[model samples]
Target chain A: MNWTLMWDSLPRLLAALPLTLQLVALALAFGAVLAFATALLRLSGNRVAVALTSAYTFVFRGTPLLVQIFLIYYGLSQIDLIRDSFLWPVLSQPMWCAILALALNTGAYTSEILRGAIETVPQEQVEAARACGMSRVRLFRRIVLPVAIRQMLPAYGNEVILMVKASSLASTITMMEITGVARRMIAQTFAVFEIFIVAGILYLLINFVATRLIKHAEWRTTPYLRARA
Target chain B: MLDLLDSGLTSGLHGWGPQLLSGTAMTIAVALSSFLLGLAFGAAGAAAKLSDSLVLRGLAELYTTAVRGVPELLVIYLLFFGGSGMIMAVAGIFGYGGLIELNAFSIGVAAVGLISGAYSTEVIRGAVKSVPYGQIEAARACGMGRWRILRRVLVPQTLRFALPGLGNVWQLTLKDTALISVTALAEIMRVAHTAAGSTRQSFLFYSVAALLYLALTTVSTTAFQQAERYASRGVRRA
Candidate 1:
């Protein structure tokens, strides 16, 4: 099973871990903000807002992340206006393009998750908060959003793991992340089996840690569910 | 600018229509093949997970966790590159040394099938678990044999419970086929990719690709919705 090859390649694969982590962190951060806005807009009871937001979610969720990444990187670059605009500086780089696509894709998914979770928050509590003379903003901030966040964390954790996996798509666009580096090593070393196995392990470790963090977050959020530790 | 955009659209549409249509067919074919293969694997996986054996359960766990944890691209890459060698090795065991070359479509199906199977295993297992134990007991009391009980009692209920989850897995399997375009298969993505590069109308080609995908998703979503309704025929929703 070439255990030595797997062991030897571990360090080299680990070298690209930082970029992978950075990509996940940035995309997830931006996706969360985008998701929050999207969820609210969809629930805002305005027909235009609802239609626009759902269409946004529909398109992103329907298409593949690879296609989205290509659309951002190669497709948009083919446009003359983008090439001449100020936005080109950010959009031209493969890394930024990958981030934008990943962020948008995850945002669409997380928004759906958030919307479902928020809907499941009891309506009576919202009414009670409002009955206590709480302002609309305060009612949402103090009563609704916190409960929704707690309910949504587990599903959001799944989204986070999905995002981490999706980050590998960045490799197709010339980003030197974990999968990208593994491909480069394979090209040079001609060790497809060994290099990918090591890279797979690295990815597994990252997801494992992510799962644990999500578990911890779940625990922290629902203090009522935990023991009196 | 408007003239340029209009020309690009007409040229891409007229020039690449057949290729795009063929590519869409290839995408659906592969997605369906992979999904059926996944159902086979998922059934076996669910049985393994449910079996009263530690080794079988652990193996099922490992398969799902490892496959689900790793990216689909890497799995596809592994199969795309190493598939021929693996097949050759298998053939060698039977005294056949002829070269084994696998087409991208088959490899894509195998890769996406395994991924789909991992998720399907969880869904099927959960569905199986949700079936009432009392119903199985009653079936046993009726002198129904194990296989008979499974066919008469369990399968129907499991299908009802598993329909929605399986629908999600189908969507996922369909989408993962896009990643399989890496093998240079003439799928929707590959066709659009080629047309884009050749025509220098990248935006036009990609938007068409996206619309094609949306059409596929919409149709499948409606079909699944209908299936769910049909499966849940007499069951009441909470």
Candidate 2:
């Protein structure tokens, strides 16, 4: 335990915090939106919609995140059509490619979490909304969605923490996120242990804060638990 | 694009299929060897944790919590770099090392084994706890030896209870082996990456790799499900 080396490495690691946060926050936000839609699609009575979402989740979750990241970044780049297409604007940048892959991967898992939450919602509530002459939109907004969101938060928190860890894979694609920066620093300083320790500590800190936020949200949602707290 | 895919698939079979086949074999070997090693560590660690002694419980807790909290990729990375150094240091103490190379296979095995042990520790601990104390006590009342009680009364039940969680750990260990590509091990992911780079058919190669992973997971999952059924035979279900 070299105190001096650790202290020296902290500031350097801190500099990479922005990129790390960017990858995590952007991916989570975008992934959340996609997940909401994917979850609904999964639950839709339409067989095609159900099949499409199922296939998406199956492929993403079955393969390694590292493989997905590589395939999206390096693999897509190899396509002549994609290179020539209008989508190339988004596909050309490694940052966008990484965010895309992370979002897609997280979306699959998040949708699963959300789907379970949705299913757990009481059937009577939807029936009551219908009896009260609520429109489908109102019924979902006033009843179904809120209940699902509350139940989904804890699992979503786990997904969020997972995404934070998963974002480290983006570093492999030349995205200079936290792990990427640490890798570069190690190459320069040859301080593998020092740099990785610093980077790992950084990840621990972020996750610690995220865990607290999730707990806070959990408490807020469970009003009965609030009294206990 | 469909025609292109057909052509690519045919060419891939002719050109790269052997590498993929070998990669699959390597993947299975890594997963199986690691799972066996993990079972050994898990059983000991779980037993230690379950012991009445404070020192044993603390040691077990430390191993599980520390390893579990850290990212698996970081653990693999640490082992990749430090493993050789540690081996060399041990060899130096024994007075022999012009360069003791712990080959890629050993490194992969050990790294995956180490990760597997961490998860297995928790799974085994949980399974052991699920076993009722009265059974062990009854064995003792019957004048059964400690070894006899463990082998006859404990091990069988723990295996049955631990199988599902161990199945999950097996899946994790399999996927984590994909990360060993960073160490330049030519497992499935690495071969896909190399083929992707060389052929510039990134999508085709990666999709194939993904399918291979899915195939592995599907087959292994079925096997585990079957084993679970076999293990639970004659047991009452809730």
Candidate 3:
């Protein structure tokens, strides 16, 4: 391993970190909203809502995110209608395309996670809340959402880490994320192992910090589970 | 759209039917080989992780954490490029160094397998833990040797417990094969990509690719559900 080369390449890769983090933040924020909507749709007791949500999850989760990225980035732009539409400008940019694909992809997986957590919320607690004449919104806010969020955090943490990794695929769409920058460096220097290793370490560092933050969140949320000692 | 579909299917003039079919076949082959390789690695890693030796456990832990933490794409790139150098060095040791190379297919299998194996290690280890300890003790008391105990008591239950998680890993492996397109393997995604670029019918080709992947995932999911049912036969459920 060429330590010097790897060390020198760190700054260039780090330069791309903001874009990478932006992608993750935007995708996750959008995806969480979409996921909540989808999950609620599935539980809404309406057949159309259930079917629509099911189809959305099935299509999005069933295919690879890379294909989805390609489809949005390259495929959608092929249509004249889409090209002429008001959304064309946003869709035309690779950055937005990548974010759209990542958001939609995570939305599918996150919906499932949220759905499972919501369904697994204690039925008795919900029943008691309802019996106490709590409004639907209040019941959801006071009981269901909090418990579900707690239950979902660990899995959601995995999704966040996955989004971080998935953001790397943005590189394929001409987005100069860390992986993209590393690939460019490799083209110029041909130090494939060193460049990639440095890139890998950067990812590992992000994940490591993310993991700790999630654990801290978990500890904060689950005070009742703490030991007396 | 109808005309595009017609052209996609026809034998001449933008015909990509045969190409897509072959690509799908390649996708299956790669996923199967990678899944098998992953199972082998998972078994070894799980064994190491579960072993009494601290060194073995530490090594296994490092393997799983590193693979899980890193992006699969980076892993593929590392293996694709770094792998050739390592292969050449090994060849050099054998006194045959004539620009040795590792093909894309082998590299794809190895890379995907390594990623899948890291995940499977956790699954298998969890499944093994789920197998009741008393059953193994009973087998030992019944004069069953180590191999006999493993076969009769441990392996069967572990497999039953691991089947669902293994099925998930299988799906992940299949999807991951798409990334191998970067290495220029003409799998489903790559074929669709080439066809889309050549035909300038990106929507048509990519939609076809997405549909194909959806079909694969749906069929495999059903097959796994059936396998799970079969595996759980004669067992009581709450």
Candidate 4:
């Protein structure tokens, strides 16, 4: 337990916290939209849409995110067509590549969570909304979405924490997040245990705070459920 | 694209088929070893968590929370770099300290096992809880000892309840082996990475790796389904 070394590494690790948070935030934001679309696609009663979304979830969830990250960062760039395209600017940078991979991976998991939540919304509530002559979009907005979001908040919180941890993989592709900084420090100092223990504590702190925020959000959103208590 | 796939698959001409297959085998080996190790740890942790001792329960809680919160990659790195030192110190206590070292495979299994064990502890604990208390009471009333009651009454129902969750943990363990590639282990992901780097045909190798993983997940899912069915035999369902 090298307390001084752990203390010295804390500031450096903290400096990289913004990048880690940025990756997680961007990925979760984009992933939420992608997840919603995926969930809706699965429920749209269109065979092609269902098949496509299912395949998307199956592939992403089945494979390791590291493989996806490497394939996107290193694999996609190998193709001359992509390298020459206008999207090359975004695809070539490690930051964008990491974000792309993280968003796609989290999107798959979040879609499943969202889909399960959506499915669990009572059939009677949806029927009542439809019987009232609410438009399809209105019915979904007024009846389905809110309830589903409430049901899925805890799961989504887990997803967010996972994304935060997953962002560490970006360091593998040369992105200098917290784990990246820790890796570099370890390489230079050979103090692997102390640095990583500090890094682990930093992650623990982030997740602890995130868990509390999620619990607070849950309590706020479910006031009806909490009224009796 | 078809030509690249052909060459990559064919045995004689620059095909990485053999290497990829070997890597897949190694991946399975690592996953299985770690899964078993995880089950052992999970059983112990579940017992500790369910026990009456405050210290035991606190220690179990600490293990689960810390491992669950931290990233798998960081855990692997800590084990990979720090493991040898810890092992050497343990050996020193036994008067056999001659540069104790762990191979990549051992470290990979140990690290991933620790992570898998945390999740498994939760699963097994939940499963144990699901077993009806009346049955255990009945067993005790029948004059059976604790060990006999555990074997005859508790373990069976717990395993049945825990199977699906254990299946998920197995998938998690399988995918986590990818992180062990950082330690330079020649698992499926590592092989794909090395082949991709050398051949510059990154898409082909990585796609193959991804497909291999999907294949493993699919096969194991079916196997688990069969096991679930088998476990539920003679039991009524609503």
Q: What's the CA error at residue B190 for candidate 4, in Å?
A: 1.2
Where does candidate 2 chain A have its weakest 10-residue lDDT segment? Answer: A220-229
Error of model 3, residue B40, in angstroms: 0.7
Output the worst ten-in-a-row residue range by lDDT, candidate 3 chain A. A74-83
Q: Please provide, for model 3 over A1-229, each residue's C-alpha lDDT reduced to its tens digit, 9 standing for 90 to 100.
A: 8999999998999999999999999999999999999999999999999999999999999999999999999988877778899999899999999999999999999999999999999999999999999999999999999999999999999999999999999999999999889888987888988998889889999999988998999999999999988
Order of quality (DockQ): 4, 3, 1, 2
At residue A196, give the lDDT of candidate 1. Answer: 79
* TM-score of every prediction relative to native: 0.97, 0.91, 0.97, 0.97
Q: How far does residue A46 in candidate 1 sit from its true spot (Å)?
A: 1.3
Clashing pairs in 2: none
lDDT of 3 at B18: 84
- Which parts of model 2 have CA positions greater than 4 angstroms off? A124-135, A226-229, B12-14, B53-56, B91-98
TM-score of model 4 relative to the true fold? Answer: 0.97
True contacts kept of each: 0.71, 0.49, 0.81, 0.80
Q: Pick the candidate with the highest DockQ.
A: 4
Q: Candidate 2, residues A79-163: lDDT per residue as tens digits?
A: 6888899999999898998899999999999999999999999999999999999999999999998899899998888788778
Off by more than 4 A, model 4? B1-13
For residues B1-238, what per-residue lDDT tens digits would candidate 1 score against the true structure? 4555578676657579999999999999999999999999999999999999999999999999999999999998888888888899899999999998999889999999999999999999999999999999999999999999999999999999999999999999989999998999999999999988887877878888898999999999999999999998897779
For residue A22, give model 4's deviation from the true position in Å: 0.6
In model 3, state the lDDT of residue A45.
Answer: 93
